[model samples]
Target: MWAAAKEYFTHPQMESFKRDVINHMRGLWRTWRSKMNCEHVKNHDNLEDILNDVPEFLIKEDWEWLVKEKFLCKEFKKMSKTNEENRALKTMNQHSGRRPVRQIALDLEEKLGRPPTVAELVFKTYKEGDMIKDDAANERHAKILEIMESNPDFTALEVVEAILGEQKRGHVICFGGGLRPKDLKSSTSTKDATDANLEAQLRRSDEEKEALHQSVIELKGTVSEQAEEMATMKAEMKKLQEMFASSQNRQH
Candidate 1:
């Protein structure tokens, strides 16, 4: 309550923070799984070896909750599908001749390198962020969350990929390119390119601003120097003219 009062986590900021938590937990799960065949380690002995590497982002109690909540996911083969994912894929499939939009979405997931939209929805509940309220997609996201609870190692991207498989070429062009640029917003590679361009542009702008500021400072100094020189010359010329007039009067 106090943290919310302090505005420590704005809505978007909280979402960003929670995304990190998902990334961290997913990483820990992958590390744990990697030891399945290591001769020096016992995979089934306990989760202790893996849990020990928990990052500072989570406390001891948080770790346990995450284990129960995000880790120990259900069997991949038996897991249920996400409604949000299903709906998204179905929408795509409807556009194409394909019977299952999920397959095409998974194919895109692999090729496009993005998580299923449904999986993104599930992260909200797992992180308990500011956007944890229920909506049309909540039920579907909940199913995915339950699966994650049991099979923590399976990432949202992987879950979608498993059903979609590696062959992207054969799938129907379901979810055809967005009618405009806004549709391309979800593409990670595209977003990365755009972000890079924006960053470079911002850097150049800053540099230009600094250069202009320095030039103004230099011009001010130059103007002051010129004014002093002009005043001195004027005074000397006036004295010379007066002296010449005095000499002429003496000659007369």
Candidate 2:
């Protein structure tokens, strides 16, 4: 429980509340042994772990304080299982038949006359529905992210254009400026040398297509000329045949 609490304490979202929770708990943790009338944690052996250790059993007063301060969250965060260890833990759970804790958190912040939390930014972003609904489009987006991660030079705009069609370009992305991954951040200048490789590819493909179209038009003109020459040749052959028949009739 203490380990989980420590993890939650370090989480990045809603830092205002989380920091206060940590500071308040720090006092409790510091005086835990004295408060509990106990000098040991985990069989009186783990002495190093004693520093800033939460008591195994919290007392009534502790519970009351947490409640009075509105620090105890009703919905437990489930980011412990996620592999995304570097990012902030999302506090809002999308469960059915439950009041929106996110809204409550926002309201509480407003009531307290505090600024919007990092958690609020996250909630608003999700509310905007940045995720692509189609599984295939999502898979393609993931692949694009992977490619960007590997390359590291591509800006978010380039990545978006590569991953999304023209219609879906702006909709495919919704990351913040600073918090976004290195690949997704649109820095004005990245390192030199094949920067516009994707753009070059698109331009080259278009050029090739135009050339192919021109070749097709030239081929059609050549075919028309061949057909006209064949028609003239057949007319000349008929005239020769008619002249021979007329000569034969005169001889008869």
Candidate 3:
């Protein structure tokens, strides 16, 4: 049994397996740690802790070997794991129920102190498969239109929820404005406009920064040149003063 285990651990394939297992374990530990009120752990610190905690699961000799072969330190591995988890968590949170179509619209209205338009709502929730008929998402499109006509202030996200909630036949309703190619084109154009505006603002800012930097450089150069000129003037004035004193002494 010892020989078999040792052989498996030494095998090249086992290196991949070890990485998968360690990564999974690290993920679980992070989740557990987050739920707790402990201070955030640094990568190296976390790896050291993991090594201490799971010495049996991750044989120290094998781990050291993997680290040497992979040219990755324990801390680096821990940092990589932490980064992956952070990204996954961010994605999960962003797609969470908080951003439902209806809710997003309502929030926008509340913030803007006005109702949103149907086109705006349609543009927000018009994912490719969202308009398709399924038992889970039926008659959503028609409902969105109905809601928009009825509630000018309602967000597109809100309209989607209302339609989905009221659906009975599991029939697909392509949101009239949402499923249209023109609507998509409009949305794309809107995004392009926004991007252009942002790019213009960034360019202006960069120009300002460059101008400021140049001004600072010029000021420094001018100050340095003035200092040198002042020094030369002072030396020449001292030499003239000495010559005048020497001539006066000679005449006396």
Candidate topping TM-score = 3
Q: Could you list the CA RMSD of all candidates, in the order they appear?
A: 21.2, 29.5, 21.0
Cα lDDT tens digits, model 3, 6-81, are 4533432334344334544666766654432122233344445533333344577765554444324666557767
Candidate 3 structure lDDT = 0.47
Encode model 1's per-residue lDDT on 99-206: one tens digit a residue. 234344444455656534434423332333545444544554555556656655553333333333432432222222211233233334422423333344355456
Count clashes in each candidate, considering only residues at least 3 apart in sequence or on different chains. Answer: 8, 0, 5
Those runs of model 2 whose alpha carbons end farther than 4 Å from true positions after fitting are 1-195
Q: 95 in model 3: Cα distance from truth in Å?
A: 37
Give per-model TM-scores. Answer: 0.26, 0.26, 0.27
Worst 10 residues of 3 by lDDT: 170-179
lDDT head-to-head 1 vs 3, winner: 3
Find the candidate with the highest lDDT and give its number: 3
Candidate 3: segments with Cα more than 4 A from true spot = 1-192
